[model samples]
Target: MTMRICALLATMMLLVGCATDDPDITVKHRVPHGSTVAVVMFQDCGIPNQADCAGSGAAAGSIFIRILSQKPGLHVASLPRPVAASAPLTDDAAVAYANKKGYRYVINGEVQDYYRTGHLALHSDRVAMSVRVLSVKDGQVLVTYTYQEDSKTHFASPDDMLEDMAKQLATSIVVEPKKQRQGDFMFYKGNGG
Candidate 1:
């Protein structure tokens, strides 16, 4: 079982690295610190030969909320799961719906790929996803990025990587802290809109 221990240790190390600076995470815009947000759940990509994750949309959204809620400055909640397997919402539609429902921001995404092969101490895992954060009031995209992590022929599972990805996502989405008032208007740095 020493091999198993080694594998687990390796996976733990990867997770530690994940929580640090992930170059894949790009923050284009930052919302207000106390914005209220909702998730529209993710839709799985029906890639040829990819693993079947029929409920992965809801799965990813749930995991995101589980982590993002722990972060300060953002109030997070999941919208009602859409009819168990409904068609995915477009970014515009999600933002409009959320705005009408009074949410300040909305999170929408799609899980492009997810697969894990092998088991025991020799598992290989990969998960690819794209996330979008939009201002519900005006449909301005605040933050967006796609992340792919593959423990190719390694010991980590996709679940561990996805959790770490969510943590990084939480970091990338905090509100823009720097604001300046010039002339008769105000603007925040890194404003995607």
Candidate 2:
């Protein structure tokens, strides 16, 4: 009985370790409460060529606004493209623009890969993206998120893939407040949480 329990505990520990997320992609500083975040248009990689890169970039930008807006207490907005041709298209530029506009944080991403490989149920919709969360005040990057799904994991459309990515991106930006400890019990800090 003792040996069985010990083996079970060992297995559980191993599983817990495996379940941990990649530390390199974790959020550094949490975005402050009651602050506005702007999401800029994602840049498309145009892999193999420039086929659907433009479309995918627009789709990604819209998806970020839609999904993140649904999160409670998160203020999400779609940052418009620069009107002046002199303004460069880059993450640093986006951050600067967001800072000037008085936003608290900014999100910028790149749609690296968007294509299907194979056919029907056996097909793999290869999708890769990288998102960065920047501090509008100091231009510091708080989070750098990257995801790639190329395995035979979906029979869904590329739009579905973008939605999934947006959901993950939300997790990286908007973190839930930690539970307050009251002796052996834990509770929310307040109604705001």
Candidate 3:
């Protein structure tokens, strides 16, 4: 009985350790304050012959736009519906579109993989995507982020995973100072003039 109890405790400890591991991986680059950004629909790059990949990319793109719309500090520009689920806008095209639309930057990417398993109970869900941030002025690539999540033990639906991924992506780019700026002068009582 004691040995069984000890084994159970060890198993529980291992599970707890695994649960606490961070799943988010993000790489960030500098984006100027108050810059306007437009999010282009992501293209689907799922496995060939897979029917489910049909609209996954567009869905991911829409999710990111919705999440970013609520984020403060940066201006979000309206973008037309994706031309094709598997066709992403080229860098030059994205830059020209942003310029024409009065935006400083553009965000676009592809949904490389997405899948859900176990229909009745929803055993697991996985999503992978690649994101790019480009400048409209020079058509320069500023940052690229690759994100993937596989949730088996956490019990999250595919939609939930996508929403969380979008939120994470939006959080990385929407940086703002905590205090509101009042023109060039920023007065602080403690700092000596």
Instruction: Residues 1-193, candidate 3: write the lDDT tens digits.
Output: 6999999998886676345334344545646667778988788865888676888877887787777777776667657644666776687887787788888889878888877664455445667888888878788777777767766554565567778876776667754564543346766788566
Q: What is each predicted model's overall lDDT from 0 to 1?
A: 0.74, 0.71, 0.72
Worst 10 residues of 3 by lDDT: 17-26
Tens digit per residue, CA lDDT, model 2, 1-193: 6999999998886665334233237688867655678988777655666465556766777987899887766889888766332223677788888878888799877777777544466555666778889987778889888876654434446667678777777766765655422345667788785
Off by over 4 Å in 2: 1-24, 83-88, 116-123, 151-154, 175-193
Q: How many steric overlaps does candidate 1 have?
A: 1
Q: Candidate 1 lDDT, tens digit per residue, 19-133? A: 5334365667876787778987777655766655666666777888888888788789888645444366689888877877788899988887777675554545677888899
The clash count of every prediction, one per candidate, is: 1, 0, 0
TM-score for each model: 0.73, 0.71, 0.73
